[model samples]
Target: QQQVKQSPQSLIVQKGGISIINCAYENTAFDYFPWYQQFPGKGPALLIAIRPDVSEKKEGRFTISFNKSAKQFSLHIMDSQPGDSATYFCAAPYNQGGKLIFGQGTELSVKP
Candidate 1:
């Protein structure tokens, strides 16, 4: 029931291209920013994340860019492939309420 606005709602990319998804939040209570990847008929899995202490972090072909001042973050997938196609959701965990607020989710399609 928290408000975390996610943009584009969906995305399409070709193999070996880059895929990017963005999300913004109004509540500054969020300390941890994480992106979850979900496939059809499966649960969401942790993909990449960043903390307020850093501006960006990269893992493999995945990267997370965080802006503390803007209360925003993004997930970038480099060299995207058909296997990378899935739904991505950005989350912000509120410590006080112990609830993880998730964005609307972005559906990514990587075509070969």
Candidate 2:
């Protein structure tokens, strides 16, 4: 149950629109849920994250919603801009704390 399934493999949003991406997991051993944003040639950067204790977390235009009972979480991007176009990944570090189980990446494209 280490897999974190994500949806809307690809999305196209108009500039200034809201972009939402979702993910679900089955593992309960995970402690930290982090959403990462990756550009074409750079490593994924931490966009936002939440703990099981927190129901939701927000950073600027990026927000992450967590459902501990459902083993799910989602990322919301408000005022999506063309610069926000990138691949996003939802991940949780295993109990051992070295490896990360990731959801299928969501590719978002913000059209101008």
Candidate 3:
């Protein structure tokens, strides 16, 4: 399997609340998991990431909770804010070239 599926296409969360999203993949060969954050009209940048070797990873207000056995992973945004509104994509490299296969894309809106 060469696909990663994500849900909630869009989400709205109040400031200081937690924003959550979920994703799953079928390919077991995939390694080097990564999550990207993008603002309108901008290229996605690496937000946070975790490999199969770890169950969780966190950075600032962002966190990635992964479940290797279930072949799923999720992103959790703590202390959500209006500035946090943006699109997020979960991805993985299919090979060494750094080519990434991404999730459908989730638009998160943190209300003030």
Candidate 4:
């Protein structure tokens, strides 16, 4: 089955701490890996994504780690703040970008 599985259904972090979410998949058809962040009343937006051949990517306080051999990827938020509280999801596009499969979201609460 084409599926993406994510862990830590909910997380609580203190301000300036690190928040991490992990995801694993079995399908090889997923050529791209992306992480999205969504607020309570907003749509999930692309937060950070990694290229197929890249091992890791870092952008500001966000980072995506890809392990091709293990079929896993993770998102890390460094120095996380209260404003970073949101539901996060990892996704992969299949069917040649025609469709996307998402993981069970991780609801993050950044405590002040």
Over 1-112, each residue of candidate 1 has an lDDT whose tens digit, in order, gives 4588997799999999999898998784757888999999999999987877789999999999988778788899999999999999998986577678889999999999
Model 2 accuracy (lDDT, Cα) = 0.89
Per-residue lDDT of 30-53 in model 4, one digit per residue for the tens? 568989999999999999999887
Residues 29-95, model 2: lDDT tens digits: 6568899999999999988889767799999999999887787789999999999999999987766
Clashing pairs in 1: none
- Name every residue pair that clashes in candidate 3: none
Superposition error at 28 for model 2 (Å): 3.3
Residue-pair clashes per candidate, as listed? 0, 0, 0, 0
Per-residue lDDT of candidate 3, residues 60-83 (tens digit): 999999888788899999999899
In model 1, where do residues sit more than 4 Å from their true spots? none
Candidate 4 Cα RMSD after full superposition onto the native fold (Å): 1.1
Worst 10 residues of 3 by lDDT: 25-34
lDDT of 1 at 3: 81
Candidate 2 local Cα displacement, residue 20, angstroms: 0.6
- lDDT (0 to 1) per candidate: 0.89, 0.89, 0.88, 0.92
